[model samples]
Target chain A: MNDPAPKTVPLDDKDFRDQLVAIIPPLRAFARGLCGTRDMADDMVQDAMTRAWAARQSYAAGSNFRAWMFMILRNHYYTTLRKNARMVSWDPEVAERVLVAGPTQQDGLNVQDVQKALQKLPAEQREVLLLIGANGVSYEEAADIMGCAIGTIKSRLARGRVALTALIDGPAYKDEPSDKGSRSPAISPAG
Target chain B: MHPQDSITMPEETVPERGLKSVKETVIASDDPIGKALRRLHDEVVAEPIPEEFLRLLGEIERKLNGAVTPE
Candidate 1:
């Protein structure tokens, strides 16, 4: 096998820019899952990209670039959420409208249902699902990105999957009121 | 199978069976939920990224390349 790339790269390296550019699509998806609206998601992604470029000097070159970038995006997302809690909470109606407008019309209903169900999950569980299930990050990478232990990641993933399946399968399940003080930060979407 | 074979089978609790099924569903690659999640992510990833992102990165690259270094 070829020797691994060094752990350090100059800030001006073209490879770094290429890697960053390559990561934007998935990064945007992650942001979309978190923010629940395309416009807000794109805005957050741009903000994250700016922050990532500004802090590129600190990145270890050979490390998991995707995970590292995801960590930065995740951190920025939570920081923004903490600063203005209302701004980041998932909005199911908006999500449905967006998904309904997607290119694939036949699959749009199911996708819309899943997105709505995803929004109903606790923020912690929803993020875990998005990162692991949707984003296809390994449990270890997800742990690194979320700054949690692997066990915590697994636990969240299991709970998230079970909860998400229930939400999607059970149409009668109503949205619970937002309990900001709870550990889950279950934000109920406004009607 | 004889009718008495039912009595010889190992007993499984309802909750345990339910949990196992949930775990299987979660772990299964072809599970509907997993498929849906991947579809959602893939749809977004397939989207054409906005031009503004590229423009912003270009601006950054230009600024970096143009900056003078001390002799």
Candidate 2:
């Protein structure tokens, strides 16, 4: 528990409402990473928010509200996954339109490429990467959110990083000797 | 309490492999993968909350108010 000791609080507390409102952005981000499409992600967030509001009485004040919310969203994501066996594939066309076209191109790894690689990862590893690497959640908080030990979180994160690196740098984009003359540079120079 | 209160974990086992070697390769914040992940997440976080969400929250608040007040 990264949060302090829990205490009882009113369900209608203004601060609770404000915190719920404030968490929507990150919640969407987390969902987007979990589900490959923006529409699906937003839908998941909406569902999570409704569930959280209904279960507001279960929330313990002074504890980590963010972690608690994340746990709810995470549980919902997995449950949805089980119910729907067909995973949503990443849409490159939508990615091109929504993602910022700048910085990512500079590093030779565009946002679309990264997202595509991310979708390849196993669900457990993917969530660990998103929670720790993207969302900046600590090991303890991540464990709590994922219902696993901190050691498990660490192992998953390491494997995820390694696997993601392999995918990005794999033969998919590598220049082949036979086609070297005809192939364009893997990355265009920054403007 | 934890939000796992209303939810149940599905019976699934995540494979643990190469634990020792992989743990040693813990990613640094400056790593390209880390940077890309952060960029992807930050991009979404930067987006404006959709109107539907605001409407949903408003509906919930209204219901809460209705529940608290006698008819």
Candidate 3:
């Protein structure tokens, strides 16, 4: 046989199969965060999962399996984007249409506002923010998945947080400066 | 499937460099914005996986097993 078998037998090992199944939740969440829609995200997840299954031999045993799956998902996304001759950009207003605003706000922070603010961030920044902040991946793993330096991931995350905060907390800051004379040191664009 | 089979794998130990912050003002997880994002993340994670995806997994499994001819 020209092609040898993979060290980790994906179908034979129940543990591996179970592991793949368990990662679906985070995989779907990451895809949705990247795609900005449930249907598109699920499509991406399905594609990624299929590819992951076919290429299971490449996966290193005892490594970060979820990270590997995430890398696959990201690669699938970028490949599809390239094939379609399109690139994803950040649109601040996209999430505003989907969020269900409740009559009561939690701790004076609205979920819809947060979603809208999140949508405002660039795709790179949002991915870093969600990967580290939301999806619970470490910077190193996120860097490996995103194919960037750890420092870059950190920088994007920091910028994403600042932008999101400005969008959510100070909605009018971008349009109308409350006081240009008095600058609040807490939130600044220099970082 | 055994009840214990569904137990999640332990999280990988974080690399020390993973904790490095790019800026002094990096938002803490306890911050209002951080909390909100985490809540959103939880909500997304809690969303049910569609039946179509489950079916896809079955198809992949069957293909791996050679039970279905490759189209």
Give candidate 1's error at residue A115 in angstroms. Answer: 1.0
Candidate 1: where are CA atoms >4 Å away? A1-12, A88-93, A100-109, A171-191, B1-27, B68-71
> How many residue pairs of model 2 clash at the backbone?
0
Q: Would you list the rank order by lDDT, best first? A: 2, 1, 3
TM-score of chain A of each: 0.78, 0.79, 0.72
**Best DockQ goes to which candidate?**
2
User: DockQ of each candidate's interface versus the true one?
Assistant: 0.11, 0.20, 0.12
**Tens-digit per-residue lDDT, A1-191, candidate 1:** 99996445534556778888999999988888777888877888888777777777776656677777777776777777767878645665676555534634353237767776777776666787888778777666666666656556666666666667678787655543322222322211112
**lDDT (tens digit, per residue) of candidate 2 on A1-191:** 49985455644556677889999999998998888778888898999888877777767655677787777788888888988866645556766554544336556456667787787777777887888788877777777778777666666666666667778888543211121113212211112
Instruction: Arrange candidates, best TM-score first.
Output: 2, 1, 3
Say which docking band candidate 3 falls in. incorrect
Candidate 1 vs candidate 2: the lDDT winner is: 2
lDDT, candidate 2, residue A145? 76
Question: Candidate 1 falls in which docking quality class?
Answer: incorrect
Q: Candidates' TM-scores?
A: 0.74, 0.75, 0.69
